[model samples]
Target: MPAHAPARPLEIAAAGPLRGTVRVPGDKSISHRSLMFGALAIGRTTVDGLLEGEDVLATAAAMRAMGARIDRGDDGRWTIDGVGVGGLMQPEQALDMGNSGTSTRLLMGLLASHRLTATFVGDASLSKRPMGRVIEPLSAMGAEFTASPGGRLPLTMRGLVPAVPIEYTLPVASAQVKSAILLAGLNTPGITTVIEPVPTRDHSERMLAGFGAELTVEPSPAGRVIRIRGEAELKPQSIVVPGDPSSAAFWLVAASIVPGSDVTVLNVGMNPTRSGIVTALRLMGADIEALAEREVGGEPVADLRVRHAPLSGIEVPPDLAPSMIDEYPVLFVAAAFASGRTIARGAEELRVKESDRIAAMAAALSAIGARVEEVEDGMIIDGTGGDPLAGGATITTHLDHRIAMSLSVAAQHCRAPVTLDDAAPVATSYPGFFSTLDALAGVALK
Candidate 1:
């Protein structure tokens, strides 16, 4: 079967007085990593709170195709039987990654050092994304690729045993790219190093260490230097994935903008690298508080209570973009309800996501009767300033899960019901999004 999921459309209306507590799905990033790292580790890796989304499921399937035994039990925990390091078998067919860029790129890295060839395929959205960034680095490590034009997907990679280890600096701040190279380094001899000029999410580095890999991160004048020993063995781990901060972002923005809303999102991962949205919302004067701060599976966790607030926009710090890159669409929703203008810059990375998020958000905002200036890299939005938005319009999702969910949040403060061309993509990251939203907004879906 094709890994890409079919689409379903949705209509969102203004539901009054969003209240009570809800936990969003497990972190998408962590969920993908748990299966991947577990597949590389010997022994059984038990994962609790795995996001049962299409994207993460695709990763698990890819791992299975490569000889890892992964099973999701009736009790909701996942048990993975790894092939151990350097033990992956050549798959009989192309590995379909669906719409998950994290899966495509990271799997390429995992496949780079083995002595086998594998073909990768993705959905229409993922097929259009440039894979050249990954191909270039892996080629230097002696892996060979025959890819579509512009280095897009539907490509084949031939892994190189005893791949060369090099110290390379990243041209862009991408956790995916950084993680890809690090995973490739695991089976090479000696140390493989990646230099990050602007640090993105550090989940790979953190989780790699938790799986017993010898990895270290050090600060330098240039940036953060990460080194991982090669030909290493990974021990299995028992993991409890904290709720996704990115998924919590939609509600955070929703509760802050909608009148009379008091929402507490529980068990969210509070890793500094992934908490930029909360920081930006606080800066914009959103009444959001992080309560019961604690640690789980080596990452920070907390409960966030957000209340309706009159917000004023400010120029979002460019440096904060990497931390909350996935949360920008909803941040723009919050901006629509703020006073004055909110300008987000230095986020060119948004252009290469499942869609051109910069233009996508701009168009959706304009369709909902908000003023948005779409720039090459980011956007400038003028808030409705606590006034209800003129939202009797249908918005396009462009096969992006974030776009669908973000527009849904915008409907909370809209004067009329908002519709999405396709909300099914929400399953890529947050499958229970509509249901959770309905529960909080007091809307029943029949």
Candidate 2:
């Protein structure tokens, strides 16, 4: 709710048993895509359960600047009137994307093939993150850009009309890069094909097809082949976003580490591409059960009932990295209280997040008395066998939301309160996190 990502310092201590059913914010990934697809579709598209987080709000603002009409009704549904493909107008001013990498990248893709030019800027954190991954490929498609050094933001982009289409293979496993190319393909002349060497989240592919875009997927020796026909028209859809599993992971890890805890997270997205946290936790000997498994809004859904159990660390499978990329901070926290050493490998992607998560967690966890060391790609953490950590240090959040919340969850087994310097970044993905943590801890945050 703050005008910017402020520093809201808070001290987190072990609360009485975490016991409750909580629905965290709607999926931030899905929320951003819903608004984007809605703004690309003709007529009216209504979205229910959209995350009102500042990240998603930044997306809404960008769409509005491009001449789309977006508003939320009293029923908590967001309605969008799109400008359709190739219909975007040049914005009057630079788009301030706040702390969302997802919004900035995806919107860049959407703007790449249109006949418009827009400048973009973000807060300190986002400005430091690399935009080269999105820029290099979009530049290949003839989109010209003037960026800060290393393709960082505070940049201006000139979209190419009737853009050239090319087949690009992903060098890394990133849903954002793939979606950007596919979104730019919307107005391209020929087919825009993306070859993904590693499968990441498939929300864009599934949602694009649902919205009447011509998209397809096939297995290839290299990896997977995805093709999108250009000049596509998107049909408006009524979308319901599922609860963010990334947010659910905090409670999952909290209940797993804190003794006498029982928590159930409801309506969480169980999409295979994004459920690596559940898998990695299970590998670490977590006592989690999937209850009431069902399908919702084209994605798998389940209620995860997590109870406190003694966990033993394992060598996290490298294949699980892409599925749970957003969850490593808390996964690191989960490892801190496990029985043995937990090694997370093949997760070089952590280096480029809102913060260098691996280094950040290594430094923070070590300072809080956990035996932690950073590797080039991942991290190694020696656990405390469920013992409370001797904590009395201020951990900096670095304008990263997950860093702020992961430490909060880590405080479950701390002897003293763990102070976070910037709890405000949590507003980007999970605004109700503290309140929900309060309710489970038997306190009223209000």
Candidate 3:
């Protein structure tokens, strides 16, 4: 949908016990990387369980624009015939990234050393996001960028053949930034190093190596040091993306708080860096158990079984911020129903996401009669001791999918129905969110 598409107002009321088993969509991070890496690999690559969300589709469209042959078969598997590393063709028009900051930033890195000039554009929300994090490192590697003011999107970037490689230390803990630097390094002639003060997701490193790139990771005094050698050849392989833990977060918190709710989410990705929500919820006394641990497409996988339980809020560790950064909104919703106050700090990164998640969640919670105090980095929430909240206000989602979905979960425990000004944003990452909620709750969310 276009950024200016009509607002999809949705209302949710308290439902009965939610009991069912379901599979969420594939991991958005992995889905994005699969298409990108597949596009740069030398042979045919097939992907199963690829997320068909708008954000992932944007990445697919961008890859197609750059001369990759991508098609979806009737069986739902996607096939990509790649042009190989350093073989990208210049896109004829500006790449419209929709709401996917991941696609925009990572593609910038991929294009950094390609000897081509491409333009990128996105929706209102994505255009507001700062792209300087990526532009800075790619620029340092000899790529030139003409971004909008404050280095936002709707920008043109010119890549350099024989790009200079440099060692860059991260100023913030961001997988997108780290991945951007590494993607740029793929087409450069020498080793490009990225020094991290804190570790984020390793999807890029893992997928890069899986696609036959020369990459190495080791411990350093600074943090984890990652080096990638450029001008490398890539070999395509079949990939099966696991269920997104981020998408499973809603049901995890929902089942924990709602009475008599017992739900199982299947095939959730359990990558250590991405499973902080489960750990944090368990810390708050959530009755969540991991069943059938296994490996899918080289990432840890498991089925999460969650049952209703009385939760007690605890001071969230600052170190866990990087791991569960995207899950904070739903975590805050979970905190609102716990037995005590939940304190979350060191998550200043939330301020720069699709929305200012801290502020957005704080306001939405307060409007629904939950006690919440907004802070510089995070929020402090006083729970209702598993009691239903007074939900009587219409929430402004600001076109953020997580916020919309989190509030929907909150509405399941509300005495009054909660209305969202725009539920369309949910399609960006989890298109079936409301329908799945319907299946579990056994009622139309309407």
lDDT of each: 0.92, 0.91, 0.94
| Worst 10-residue lDDT window, candidate 2 | 1-10
Q: Can you write out model 1's per-residue Cα lDDT over 358-403, one digit (the tens) per residue?
A: 9999999999999999998899999988999999898999999999
Q: Estimate each model's TM-score.
A: 0.98, 0.98, 0.99
Query: lDDT of candidate 2 vs native?
Result: 0.91
Candidate 2 clash pair list: none
Looking at model 3, which ten-residue stretch has the lowest summed lDDT? 1-10
**What is candidate 3's lDDT per residue for 376-420, written digit by digit as tens?**
999999999999999988999999999999999999899999999
Tell me the lDDT of model 2 at 106: 97
Measured with C-alpha atoms, the lDDT of residue 357 in candidate 3 is 94
Stretches of candidate 1 off by over 4 Å are 1-6, 444-446
lDDT of 3 at 426: 97
lDDT rank order: 3, 1, 2
